[model samples]
Target: MKTNNNGKKSFVQRSLDWIEKVGNKLPHPVVIFIILSIITILVSEWVYRAGVSVEFFDAKANETTTINAISLFNSEGLYYIFQSAVSNFTGFAPMGTVLVTMLGVGVAEWSGLIGSALTKLILKVPNSLLTMVIVFAGIISNIASDAGYVVVVPLGAIMFAGARRHPIAGLAAAFAGVSGGFSANLMFGPTDALLSGITNVALNSSGNPYEVSINGNWYFLIVSTFVLTIVGTLITEKVVEPHLGAYHGDFNEHEASELSLKEEKGLKNAGIALLLSLVVAFLLMNPWFGPFQTIDPETGQKTLQPFMNSGLLFMVFLLFAVPGYVFGKTTGKIKDSNDFVESMIEAMRSMAGFIVMAFFASQLIAYFSHSNLGIILASKGADFLQNQNISGIPLILAFIIFSAFINLFIGSASAKWAILAPIFVPMFIAINLSPEMTQMAYRVADSSTNIISPLMNYFAMILVFMQRYDKKSGIGTLISTMLPYSIAFLIFWSVLLIIWYALNIPLGPGAPVQVSMIQPLIGLM
Candidate 1:
């Protein structure tokens, strides 16, 4: 028994060392994206010249279609590459969202509103439930998009530090919930709309005339929210915290201080500001009088609508900015408008690396899309699966595993699903499985692997957060530390999904595991 235990320990240590070594040897993420962009351009040319084509069933077109690679090395491709470069960078989804949201969050953090609020809130919680609260908060924070990564994750570390526990454990738990449990939210957010929209496109493409609602997986995800919280708490307390032992780090002395009179006043003012902001937002979104309300062309009904499908981001901005500005004024952190502007500028400065990386990433993604490589690969993969004579639960499990493996390579969940949905949604439908079931499985796989994927957009940000305490922390340290959470989430979540499938639970409103009337197509099988 002792020998076996020693062997396990030795193996773990060696694996960690190797991961660290390999990760450390890699170029900076921005450079890596630039190299990838160049490679993609070359590959597009090569594939186009070689006449690589795939026969895919175009669901939207309701017919078979041949997809050919478009080479980016030609005159037309060169013009596109040059013309679209600036637009690509400017229009990158995360670029604008993060920048705009941070303008508000920056003021809050600079004004000490976030710190004070977090301290008071966390200090009130019993030590035993601290992990649970942090984890749960992180899970729910997905409603505000990437705010959790910026706010809740670091706050978890701070709260844990204040409680005299291993701060990294708190960080891990929060990260697990924020990224690993990203799809598991109690409320539907922008991600729901974004992913479901893509799924709908794929469904339409696959000749399915029905559109999936945004809340297709809401029920399953709500339950998953609690499951992740419970699992995150257990893993943090039992495995990660213990393995981390005690913290004798630079942040040990950074305990929470009692709220001062001015801070108290600031909090009061901030609360009032938040309430007012909410009221204003509510009015703006009201169907009867709201300026943002519009008529849906297809449905021909008046409706309160999101601003460019990004009402959540705008709402977050309002929630943070109003409270932050009030807090800053009340606490004398901002004596004038200059201070507020400075705060926003400082926040933008911090995101310089992300901006640089986004430029290259945008190019890479654009090139890849033009090349038709993603769709080709997805179609081939689906064809291979179809030929295997697999169906039912086993097929679902295999797909979940395949998605997880692919996640390690492709970081963006939406981008990956955009490619995979057209292939799998119809295939699954042909086999009598509901599109919702296929989507649910994909979500499970995507969220579970987020923490360990180096290509994840926020991965570098996570490292920077870790380095605040441990200067030696790097890509390997972050991955190794997070590996346990990833494994636990993947195993437990997959089990939950399988159980859900077996019990034939409704994934959401009108979403079922299998469709009764839809018989399997024997010819396709």
Candidate 2:
């Protein structure tokens, strides 16, 4: 019995060590993107010289068109490269969303509103449901962009410590939800818009243009949110927390205190401010008298189209900014205009690393698109799958596994989707599947691997958080801690998707699992 236990422990340690060593050996994410861009250019030139091309079935135009690779080494390519560099960085989808949203979030964090509120809320919850609440909060934090990583993840560790549980277990559970369950949110967020936009681009490129709603995967994601919460809770309570054993380290039990008079007042004032903002948003988004309402030209019916299209970001900005500003004033955190400006500046400062990464990522995406490599590969890959006659569940499972594997290398969700959607969306559509379903599958796969992937943008940050408790914590420690959640999520989430497919459920509003096949149309090469 002792030998068996020792053998199991040794095997687990060896596996974690291997993962950490390989992950640490990889180049920095920015360097990887730069190298990928250069390789794409070289590959494009080679493929162009070799006259390698593929014909895609265009259902709309009723004819097949050949797509050939374009080399980026030519004069025109050089001109495009030089001309589009600045625009690429500025126009990167995640860049604007993260920056704009953080302006509001920075104010909240700087004012101490977020921390106080989180402490109060978590402290009041029953211990039995504490893990579930933390996981749920982490999942929902996506609606506010990346604030969860900086706030909820650390808070989870602190809260768990206060509760006398292992901090690392709490950290793992929170990280599982924040990064691994990123796509499973109760509400549509900037991620939905970002990925949907890319999916639309892919659909259009495939000669089967269609508009995808922000709620493209609403039903599935809503269900996924609960599933992840339950799975995360069970894993933490049964597997992770128990494995960590008791807390022998020093942790401040008094870290989470009951709300003080000033803090309570600030929260009340902030709540009022938030309520008022919501009221105004409701009025503005109302179809009856709201200026933001629109009348469809064809239907001659009033609709909240304008608000639905752009109001989410504006609402998020206001939801955080108004409450934060109110709390700051109430708590004397904001003394003057200078303080407010400084808060926003600090927020932007925190995102400097992401911005740097986005610059390289944007260039890589642009190069790949210009070179037509993604489309070509997607086409060939789709053709190969078709040749094998692997349609339906097996194909989707294969794609999910492939995507999970890819996540180990690429960290950015939007960046990966931007590249894959062009190929997969069209290919799936050709096989009588909806783009929405394909996007959902990608989300499932992308999220399932995020906890284990060191390439994730927040992985290093999470390691730093963990090391606060375990001084010896490193890449291996974090990976070994999070590996179970990663494996469980991938297996269970993939199974859920399979079950969803079997039911032929609608993925979102007007988005079904399958689409009726139409005759192929002519496509542009």
Candidate 3:
């Protein structure tokens, strides 16, 4: 009996250690993706009913195109799987957008402008205000792609350590801001543009006439930025820091303060240069006779209703290009123009891995769409869900829960939106609820789960990082660390949205919280 009891205690201790250490340390994102992929494939079939057709068009012509009656996976036999996979991976993937955006974004990062500017600016704030600023910076860093992961996270850890707080707490706080605040930002970005384009596609397919502008979700996102900052700071100070105890780890103070006076000066000059560049770009883009202007002269009618939409990609290019060159020149990082080109080249090279992953992911999505599986499932699922008779606050609450759960498996906000938009957007539109509300709800769900989902590519990287700090942290450690923010954000953000919806606030320019369903407004091509 004594021996058994001893053994039982030993086993229990091991189990607890595993849960606290090894299990939590295990890479989460890849594991989650594999599991979700399996489930998605298992629960869904490629085939739908015969004679069903979805109309679309080929890119080559103005003529109409149609997605025919049956699943290619079934009708075309075994070989179709490979073909479908190739099509999915190669065509209509979000990878290109990521690549194109990164090309411009990477230049800013590689040139040291992003890091230098953030460090100098953030460090100048009083220590009391610095933490919040750092968190806010992390949230805004999403616009620069990898800058948050590469610069902010480590910089944050170091910043907290300098102030004699637990470094891991700082790291966690920064990571939370960067990933947790992914969906909310002050500025419109490439992701916004891409997602909006896809949203328009989904809406137009359902016979809606007007274009859904990129800034459609901007109003709510602006509010979310403040909410994320407050929540992030509160979580860091209250939950994460206390849980982390004190900083006992080995840290080099000098390493944390490596920025030289030259770099600081360079950063200031770069800022001025960036401002000048923006001025030039605005002057060029906005001029009635400038080559950059898209409007027609004869009619005096504007070609681009949302100027931001037409100039977004170019704005991205200028955002990076001028800052990068200015920083490189002032800091002697670029001795000449050749150096600037080389910096851009190196930035593109870094995305090789992302491009590869995107290839596979794209294939999966494309093939799924090509198979007509998404439409079939969407139509059936929406039909059933619409008939469920859930309404008002309860239905909205249910929508939140549903979106949150789905978010755990699918990490890409836009990709998940693309899939869910077709289903939920139409359903909400069919009812009295608006697509803007549904989209906003989806964004809330998508952002909240990012911290917890192991399927998030970065989630695994974060686990590896935690293990470096404490060999015993694992899935539970990560989840537990972030769970507070997740819960708080969900409740508070949802309440905020509910209030917004009830007040009938416009989500963006002309984007109503609710649309009249009794007499649907139709637009002609």
**lDDT, candidate 3, 240-275, per-residue tens:** 676665666665541234578878788788789888
For model 2, the superposed segments whose C-alpha errors exceed 4 Å read: 1-13, 57-66, 138-222, 234-254, 295-311, 390-396, 402-487, 500-525
Model 1: ten consecutive residues of lowest lDDT: 516-525
Worst 10-residue lDDT window, candidate 2: 1-10
Mind giving the per-residue lDDT tens digits that candidate 2 earns over 280-391?
A: 9878877689888888785598866555545566577678888998999998999899988898999888677667767887787778767877656655654555457677
> How well is each residue in 1-525 modelled by candidate 1, as lDDT tens digits?
012344453454455556756765767656767887888888889888999888755544444568888889999889989999999778766666677788888899888898788778767888899999999999998886777887788778878887778777788889999999998999877788777877787766655666678888899999999998999899888667655556778554546678999999999999999999889887888778888788878569775544645666767877898899999999999999999999899888877766776777777777777777766666677667767888888999889888887787567787678667777887788877888889989999999999997557677667666766665666666787788788888889989988998899988998887874343332211
Better of 1 and 2 by TM-score: 1
Residue 7's lDDT in candidate 1:
48
Ranking according to lDDT, highest score first: 1, 2, 3
By lDDT, is 1 or 3 better?
1
TM-score of each: 0.86, 0.72, 0.64
Backbone clashes under 3 angstroms, per model: 4, 10, 12
The parts of candidate 3 lying over 4 Å away from their true place are 1-118, 138-221, 240-261, 287-381, 408-439, 450-484, 501-517, 520-525
lDDT against the true structure, per candidate, is 0.79, 0.76, 0.64
